[model samples]
Target: MIGLEVSGGIWKATINRPEKANSLTAAMLTELAEIAERAGHEGARALVLTGAGRVFSAGADLEEAHAGLATNPVWERLSGAIAALPCLTIAALNGTVAGGAMGMVLACDLRVMVAGGKVFYPVMKLGFLPQPSDVPRLRSLVGPSRAAMILMAGQKITAEEAMSWGLIDRVVDAEALPDTVHALAADSVGASPAHATAIKRMIWA
Candidate 1:
């Protein structure tokens, strides 16, 4: 499930199904894409994507994934929506991030992760490849060598390692994650929305 709320010039989208480690289902991915689109149309100055509990997301729900179906198209659309948002986008990684969920994280303009959290892409081990859109995004964040290491070598990166590798911008205590993200969002409130949007467009252009 996905939960969306807008306040203080920020649109927050939370992955609320903690019971299953917030694994994304087809319906949830659709909701996320819609939320991202709505946030842009609603004039949000910033967007934050995060999970409700200790795990950011375990990636696509295996059940749905194995049922002669593919959610990659929807997932790609969601990632594209986040990347194409005119406003700033931040991924608040309150917990572990794994598998296809890494695409969404990389699509964000910035990322703040909880200390001790882990990030891994298991596509290699699972006998698949990262989505076409995801490969370049990940490569851009950490460079080709490191990206290969993550994608081909199946390395599991820690929060500290992720920051060092340029996969995330900040790592904070779990308890401070929300406050830190809120502070970052609040600090951006003073910027001219037009200027911010322009800069974002140019950066991603």
Candidate 2:
């Protein structure tokens, strides 16, 4: 399940099926994409993607992955929608992130993770190619070799390592995570929609 909260020009979308390690289903992916699209169209100044539990996501749902979810186009749609948003988008990594779940994280303008969180993408081991845009986005953040280390060798990296590698922008205590996100979002949320979007465009340009 996905939960969305919008207030004061900020849109927060939470992946809520923590019992499943927040793993996504096709329907969930579709809903996330729709929410991202709506955030863009509805003049949100900031958008935060986060999970409801200790683990951000373990990637696609196991049962669904076995049934062709691994290669689904919905992954691309969701990430692309997030990437296209003019709002300041952040992936507030509540905890570990693995497999296809990293696609949306990579699309974000910033990634802030809990101090002990881990990140890994095991497409090579799983025999599935990542979403189309994910490759370049990931390489841009963490560089080619490090990206290869995760994708090819399936090496799991800690939050500090990910931050040093440039994949994660910040690593903070779990208790401080919400305040950190709010502070990072404050200026944009307080700005005029056009002003915030213009600055975001300039930064991404």
Candidate 3:
């Protein structure tokens, strides 16, 4: 499921399914979309998406997939909401990210990952394609060549490689992750909220 907490102008959303490696279900995706919408309406200065345990997310739940539950629409809605939030948004990747979860990571305005964490896209291996919206976003962040490496080659990009490719903003030791994200949130909270929102919208436009 999704866990939400708001304090000091920062909203945090955590995927709380450690036993399953935080693999998202239909209900979880719905809750996440609602949380993202609420964060916007409540005028939080910053929003952070992370996982409860070591794995950020294992992506869509295969069990749900077998049950004919299509997660694409809900996932799209959630990621879109995160991307369109007026305030700054961050994906504090506490650990590895894989599959459809990469869309959520890419949607964030900035990303900070643990040094040993990795990002793996299994599109080619699984015989699936990246979402239409996700393709351009990934391409814009890391360019077409790297995007190809991820989508076509099914590459597992290490934190250092991801940082060098411009996919992630920062990489820090696991123990420093929380403090780093807190400092970033504090800085965003100190900025002029209205200006930050306007600039973010303008840049996206």
Candidate 4:
């Protein structure tokens, strides 16, 4: 399941299947694109992507991924939707993020992780390589050495480590994540809208 909330200038997109660690089904992915598209015109200055349960996302629905119809193009469409979002895109990584889940975080402009949460990249294990389209962002975030480790070794890095390595902007107590993201969004709104948009455009460009 996927959920969307637009309130107080903060547009939140959440993964709603805590029972399944917020895994992404095909329907969920389609909803993600729709939510993002809707947020585009909602006068939202900041967008927060989060999860309903302990885990941010366990990654793509494994069953869906294995079904062979979850084609690369579908993933690209979702990725494009996220990448094209105009407002500040913030990821509140509440827990373990893996595989395609990691891609969602990478698509965002900023990411905040819970102190003990983790991130994993396992594309190689599944006999595939990193998406060429996503490689640039991943490389810029962690540099070649760390990106190689994630892509080649499929290692899982703790949230604390992620902060230190610059993979995530901040690490907060698990319970504090929502408030932290709220504060961040509010801070964005506190800035000049013109300047904020300009800065965001420059950063994204």
- List clash counts for every candidate, in order: 0, 0, 0, 0
Give model 4 RMSD, 1 decimal.
Answer: 1.6
Model 1, range 1-205, lDDT digits (tens) per residue? 7888888899999999999999988889889999999888888888999999999999888888776224458888989999888888999999999988888898998899998899998888887668778899998889999998889999999999999999989999999998999888875666988989877778878
Cα lDDT listed for each candidate: 0.88, 0.94, 0.88, 0.81
Give per-model TM-scores: 0.95, 0.98, 0.95, 0.93
lDDT of 4 by residue, 1-205 (tens): 7778888777888899999888888788878877777777566678789998789998778888888524555556666667777777899988888877776688888899888899887888887666556677788988999987888888888888878788999999988999989888776777766677788889877
The TM-score that candidate 4 achieves is 0.93
Q: Relative to the unseen true structure, what is the C-alpha lDDT of residue 71 in candidate 1, on a scale of 0 to 100?
A: 41
Q: Relative to the unseen true structure, what is the Cα RMSD of model 2?
A: 0.8
Task: State residue 17's C-alpha deviation in candidate 4, in Å.
Answer: 0.8
- Candidate No. with top TM-score: 2
For residue 19, model 1's alpha carbon misses the true position, in angstroms, by: 1.1
Candidate 3 worst ten-residue window by lDDT = 65-74
Q: lDDT winner among the candidates?
A: 2
Give the per-residue lDDT digits (tens) of candidate 2, residues 113-201: 99999999999988889888989999988889998999999999999999999999999999999999999999988888889878878
Q: Which 10-residue span in candidate 4 carries the lowest summed lDDT? A: 68-77
**Per-candidate RMSD vs. true structure?**
1.3, 0.8, 1.4, 1.6
Enumerate residue pairs that collide in model 3: none
